[model samples]
Target: MSYEGSFRVWRGDDDAGGLVDYQVEVNDGEVVLDVIHRLQATQAPDLAVRWNCKAGKCGSCSAEVNGRPRLLCMTRMSTFSPDEVVTVTPLRTFPVLRDLVTDVSFNYEKAREIPAFEPPKGVAPGDYRMAQVDVGRSQEFRKCIECFLCQDVCHVIRDHEQNKPAFAGPRFFIRIAELDMHPLDTREGRAEAAQDEHGLGLCNITKCCTEVCPEGIKITDNGIIPMKERVVDRKYDPLVWLGSKIFRRQT
Candidate 1:
């Protein structure tokens, strides 16, 4: 049940670093985080990795496992063979602050860009009620733990560093979609802002963000595509165009 697992963990800070090989003890029914802790205890005492609530709910232990963004606590050691060298690396999309931890402040910056949910002026906190079906739509997106895996995996900002400024990435796309879908929300032109400002158009529906989500959120299918459809409906539909023009004249 116990074996020496070959691990190649990235070591160093923002200035410079490389993958340092380590032979760590692995046990049955253990996750990657366990192996990492064992490595810290035995071999690499100075290793830098961030983790909390090792139960996978805190979203604090995100890293690239064999080049895929995943929660270290959720990825089981059994997924890889004993002979296979497991490569743990910092998220390539963000600036590396240390070993497994990166500067995730970009996600916080993107979070700041999002406007909070705006309810109609007349509706009191307790007086408002929404249908079960309507509430279900936004509820799915609320499950996000702010892990930033979706943002890290998104190619718009991941592959192209320049796109970071314009693109809000999948996490915020779902947030915007949640607010836009809320029946009681008074916000207008959400779809327009999604397309024009947040760089929603950059997404090609590849669903990479959905794949890496530990919560199994249907980010692309449930959120992004619906918002894309809304954007098309608002922009290209003749009746909507006419209504917009008339509303412009009235204003």
Candidate 2:
């Protein structure tokens, strides 16, 4: 169950870099992160890899395995043929800090933009109660480990860095969707921001984000698309549009 394999790990920093190949030992039940760790131990101790917990919980080991976004600690070495060369690279959407480590601060900036949940007026902490179904829906999004794989795979910003400023990407879309769907949250303007500010309209219903999710969140169908529908309902619902025109107060 042990064999010699190869890995092409990108080596360098923000200024410049390239894929540096290395021959390494592979064993049964080991994941890609294991191979990378082995390379560090014996061959490339200076190799920079950002990993914590090695359990896929911290999500700090996110990288591109053969150009697809994945959690390195979760990708089984057995999934590849014994002699196949596995190429590990930093996330393409973000600036690389070093080998296998990219700057994920974009996600944090997007996270800060999402408004926190606010209860309806007169509602207090003691009065907080959510239906089981609503609570279940919100809980599913909370399962996200902040891996940002969804954001990395999202084509809106993956190929075009210029779009990054306007796009919230899939991860924060889930956050916005969760708050908008929460029955007890009194927050308004999330649906509006999703369309105008967050660029929810850019998504064309491709579920690439859901595919790479270690948590298996139904990011497109359950979160993005539903949020898109709500945004549409708010903007173009004829009855509401007419009601706004007729009933809007004049200063």
Candidate 3:
């Protein structure tokens, strides 16, 4: 049976906007993005939907499907009843550029703030060895495609817009944690960076960021929690304090 539905896509430039409904026909196994293309070709020539590598690898084509942040190409039309109207909107966390497009410059700016990796002296180019198990720990974070779905779903930036300035969001926390856990990383001040106003403390461990992560990065459990632990140990661990005092006297 052929399925047909109406998609009420958000349309317009930065100056104005409104929902414009487009009727589309679909076959079994077709995705919402496929239907969107049909609408663009036939109904609305000026419609805009950002996308690349429709196979869900590029992480573009990310938008709020029925108010949920998801990759449209990965979302099948079968999930909803044929009679239902699917509403596609831009990610709510950032300023919209135009219909279904948002200016994600904020994330780029945050990325620039993170310190680059500075490995220890003993770690040679190819000689920086790490156990496979230890290497596996940070590998999950490496799968991130920069979709920003986690950022879109985070209440720290969504519901509480005021926190955006000081909150680095979950993605960067994962980066920090990954580098901090790197065996060769001899850089100091990670604990301070994680505990800074725009760091781990901003994450309330709501796990919303984890839930929206397409790569399945355990943001709260692996990244944020461990970072918090490191911060606590640095500030309050008795042994660290004692060792610091003893080392200072010896020097």
Name the candidate that leads on lDDT.
1
For candidate 2, give the lDDT of residue 74. Answer: 96
- lDDT for each of the candidates? 0.92, 0.90, 0.85
Residue-level lDDT of model 1, residues 1-251, one tens digit each, is 99999999999999999999999999999999999999899988888899999998999999999999999999999999999999999999999998998999988898898888888898888988888887899999999998999999998889899999999999999999999998788888889999999999999999999999999999999999999988987876888678777776321
Which residue window of length 10 is worst by lDDT in model 3? Answer: 242-251
lDDT of 3 at 144: 84
TM-score: model 1 vs. ground truth: 0.94
Winner on TM-score between 1 and 2 is 1
Name the regions of candidate 2 deviating beyond 4 angstroms.
240-251
- Which residue pairs come into collision in candidate 1? none
Q: Rank the candidates by TM-score, best first.
A: 1, 2, 3
Instruction: Say which prediction, candidate 1 or candidate 3, comes out ahead on TM-score.
Output: 1
lDDT of 3 by residue, 91-169 (tens): 9899999898899889999998888778778667887777888778678788888899998999989999888889888
Scored by TM-score, the top model is 1
Per-residue alpha-carbon lDDT of candidate 2 for residues 51-150, written as tens digits (9 for 90 to 100): 9988989989999999889999999999999889999999999998887789999999999988888898998889998779767887889899998999
